[model samples]
Target: MNGIPNELTIERRMAVPRDAVWRAWTEHATEWFCPLPWKAPEVEMDLRPGGISRVRMVGPEGEEMNLTGVILEVVPGERVVSTDAIAPGWVPQTAFMISVTEFIADGDGTLYRASARHWTDEARQQHEAMGFHEGWGKVAEQLEAVARRIA
Candidate 1:
């Protein structure tokens, strides 16, 4: 609260058009969004303003983490904003967060960026210590693959 907020900004170049990148963020593409070495078992996406997307992943120990959020805004082939407020059925989130994802055309490809906003400085530090870079980085790498496949 006294200093500038801490955040993680990740940028990746995808060998795909903006539209293809959009698909990878939608319901049908949740599988690929799962960072490798983990398996996604379920995905439900309602891709529109106020719509919701829920994804369930299975860890190595078969533990499942279900994440769900509502779409705050969606600009086809441009950007998507979503709040990690509630889970499926509008259940409260254990760790609240908001995400803004953008896709910029980079001449024959797209520049993809996703930023996460937390409520407190401590939360931000916690996320950083938790390896958001490695976790999200892996997912971003997977995103490039998914986008290229459909490009």
Candidate 2:
């Protein structure tokens, strides 16, 4: 994990069914999944290996971040792996910052984990210092809330 700088790891357990959690993560156009503060009005997802998932999250000051990443693997109601970056496609916008998110089932719920890989230690430390924990933690909370409601 040392070599992978700018890397961020988050693990959370939510009380929801695996399938429901998967839907929250995979289903496009589910605004509930995006949650409050960051409004994701639309999302396009293929949910298959090699397929691309496009997501747009609208924020304050009319700010919008368009995220597009390819699905590396998907095991139905179990696991999903995808790499995220600022680039328009699967390409990395910055070599120092990239992310891989993994969803795993833990007992009656699902355990969500995301790892951010950076090109250098400096970048990693910078990101950590920038409050990644709270940022990702909020999204995780949103995911759990939506999943529980739909389940």
Specify the highest-TM-score model's number.
1
* Candidate that scores best on lDDT: 1
- Clashing residue pairs in candidate 1 are none
lDDT tens readout by residue for model 2, 1-151 = 4455356787888878777877787762445534467788777767677677677888766788777766667777666665554333456644445566666778888888767776677877887887777777777887777788778
TM-score of each: 0.85, 0.77
Model 2: colliding residue pairs: 5-118, 6-124, 7-116, 8-116
Error of 1 at 111 (Å): 0.3
Give the clash total for candidate 2.
4
Q: What is each predicted model's overall lDDT from 0 to 1?
A: 0.76, 0.70
Clashing pairs counted in every model: 0, 4
